[model samples]
Target: MTILVEKPVLALEPKDVSNKDDSEKEMAAKNGFFAPEINSFGNSFRDYNAESARQSTVEEFYRLQHINQTYNFVKRMRAEYAKLNRMEMGIWECCELLNEVVDDSDPDLDEPQIMHLLQTAEAIRKDYPDEDWLHLTALIHDLGKVLLLPQFGGLPQWAVVGDTFPLGCAFDDSIVHNKVAKQNGTTLPPAALFIIRFHSFYPLHTAGAYKHLLNDEDAKSLNWLHIFNKYDLYSKSKDKIDIEKVKPYYMSLIEKYFPAKLKW
Candidate 1:
């Protein structure tokens, strides 16, 4: 029943994926508009709980995410994206690039990439007539997933989406596939019940998850993340959003929600 069926969706760029060093690729991504901290979280949440599947679920997250996302890594990201060089292109192009692939790892979605965005935006527009920013939220919250692209920062599916949690603090118990806590070293005592949940973004709702860490724009966009994530995570179906018909409606919504010009 996985909607993200294994379609021949990903298209290799004409230039081919470069084997350039990680640091060089990171720098190139900055020049192209990739954001920071998005890669900080990997598919940590996607790992199975344990070797036996019954011997107390333990996720292989700490073994990887801890090393990939170190203190220095966060600081390096901050320094890189502060200049925002990576995104010198049009936003539409980024969306199109992202649209080239589907999140096959996701169980509930079977739609095209663009259709998924439309579904999320349309679902919100149905409820809140006046919340213009919500339309923008639905459209952009998953922009971080563009990291799947090489130019944007070729991140794995596990990194881009899953139940999101806080970094500096401890993990929470509300995680959907809640076995990730069983890694050899994954302890829950000190940061008891700090687990991150689905649709968590607003500092208001998430008990200041990223409030202190995020800048104003990221914080403000937290609303859109909150509003859109409802559908991003839940709005999937065997059905799909009609691309031709839904495009104009979404454009209007985006116009209403976002300013005429955005940085990336």
Candidate 2:
């Protein structure tokens, strides 16, 4: 059965920071806020060049992820993991777990995942101090990658991380390897969920390719998701942040939004 879907015309223009609140502007100045750029390696960020040291491994990771991330596999994974029976720990503990891990799929930075989380959250906080929810959202967006740990199902990097896309629809060209799904069992706010699920769905947000699948609410959330992609994707750097200094602030946020201990 073939059905025709009309893509909505969206005026998703970029927001001007020049007119932002004075406090935010001041914060940006103090923090050296600027648009994200390519890494020091002289390659474009996420460039999978065959000659690059990280490219072969990154490509292989995506190759496996693309081949195995099928619809039935997704369903099976959701059923297995949704029980959330793995461990009971505070959110900061989960963040600490990532210190032992690095993302093999990433070509830009090779630091531990917790460093990336802190870099992303700190970058966003500098530009939008009032948006505490957004700051928290950046901190924990990749917590799902803990699936790589032996205690939490020990899933392969292919199954746990990489660019994401919608599964039942066409694989848009903007998404890397272009395959995916939404999640369930999350108690996060709609906006946070939008960022968590679709942050990897670059085809829709970056290329404007999945407008036909979106309704009014999806469109509204898309705005914030766009704002978040900047920090999530491009905030990696060699600059180190002192974890002890910032840990208390993020712990407070976790306590506010999440219970003292979560199921996973």
Candidate 3:
């Protein structure tokens, strides 16, 4: 005999969704926080083939990063940078420093780095109000780009920014900032660390590369990273976020998770 069992409505039922969601959605629409289908340059986001002034620079950056980021090179960079001796400053201070840095690797927006950080953070905050850690993650995700500044050793754009990847046999490209956060004593959870570490890892998260290396824990963390990446990439635009208005809120989060001053 064949039997069929009744299925429960496991997905979020309409009644389960609170009015807060509707209100948040309305606010997002009113403020134009919705993710755009096209990037600021009138092309799909991360389209390396799109012809523009930035296309050549981005392509060159990838070429250099792939050729130079070998296993021994990454190991040396990691060990040398792990000392955290660059400088002692608070998280907010680091945000201020990013105003001087520009990411030539990015093709979409040419605005100051701080604006991008705020835009990403505010977007995440509006959508996921309760996840303060996520909001903070968005804000400080690229602060590691400060490595491009003179005081931070004035590293080249190829070393400091762009899509990072593992350097060994199955190499792909991404960023390298998790060490700064971890060695600096961040109390954020593993998921937060994973997102911060691999947000620029488009190969693993976007193209499904490097799957063989992930554990069950990394799989669970990938879910959060996927959500974080949406804001990280799509939030790029010419729109300017009010720094003074959002400063107080992000400061509270920094205090909650990191010490007043961190090494490097």
Candidate 4:
């Protein structure tokens, strides 16, 4: 399906170094290339280094995530959440709700969750202007993190945010939190769902691990996931987005792929 999305008037411009703090300047310098280098904190993106203050808390979050995110726990959470009874709201409403959320598990960003979502979607939109479904996919990919909110059962950060891996299989070494634990397309294509579900499964896509667990369909979906990962991981920055200016554009895309209101 060809989704019609109005391009927002406020383009996401490059950060002006003159206005940035020392750390932000350093980060902007590192992000000079398509694939940026270590973060401004001088730690690799998602580094989780034991001694680095910026990464240490993230490491601890992973420690808890690794121990608790077992097959049974995943299964139970799926069963409970699959009911979709938390609340009913439009996709944009959910996006606005994320303005109050922060991902404690992320080492790269401390901003509100909506910024990351918009940043990723806008970055992908700029590069793949014709792929409106991909743009919408990027916007809603992390809507699942709404589980962290009180109305959604108030799940801990470990349960909602952070990199995700498969529960039925062994954790792969390439996954960032290995030391601790562990998509869609056009009208929200099947490929887009695959990317949203498994982007954090770095072992399968990035590391060439876990081939044994994937069937033929999964193998095919892996290709799109690889393409999606670049924008998802590398689009993050210290730059702020003007939500009021961009909200109309994303709201249009959300209307295309999803109902006005979705079950939580």
The per-model lDDT (C-alpha) reads 0.46, 0.78, 0.78, 0.75
Decoy 2 TM-score against native: 0.84
lDDT (tens digit, per residue) of candidate 3 on 1-264: 853433222112111112346677576677535677698889898877799767877777766765666678778878877889988999999999888877887887777899999999998776677778888889889988998888988888878888767765644433322222166777677788888889888879988888888999898788888778878888899888989998999999998888799998
Better of 1 and 3 by lDDT: 3
Once superposed on the true structure, which residue ranges of model 3 sit more than 4 Å away at CA? 1-28, 171-181
Candidate 1 Cα deviation (angstroms), residue 115: 2.5
lDDT of each residue in 117-165, candidate 2, tens digit only: 9999998887777667777889999998899999998999989988876
For model 2, the stretches where C-alpha displacement exceeds 4 angstroms are: 1-15, 18-32, 177-188
Whichever of 1 and 4 has more TM-score, that candidate is 4
lDDT of 1 by residue, 103-122 (tens): 64443443456666666666
lDDT at 119 for candidate 1? 65
The runs of at least 3 residues in candidate 4 whose Cα sits more than 4 Å from the true structure, single-residue gaps closed, are: 1-33, 181-186
User: RMSD of candidate 2 to the true fold?
Assistant: 8.2
State how far residue 149 of model 1 sits from its true place (Å).
0.4
User: Positional deviation of 165 in candidate 2, in angstroms?
Assistant: 1.8
Q: Write the per-residue lDDT of candidate 4 for residues 104-185, one digit (tens) a residue.
A: 8877777788998998888777656767777888888898888888999999888888876777766677877576650122
Q: List the candidates' TM-scores in order.
A: 0.54, 0.84, 0.84, 0.81
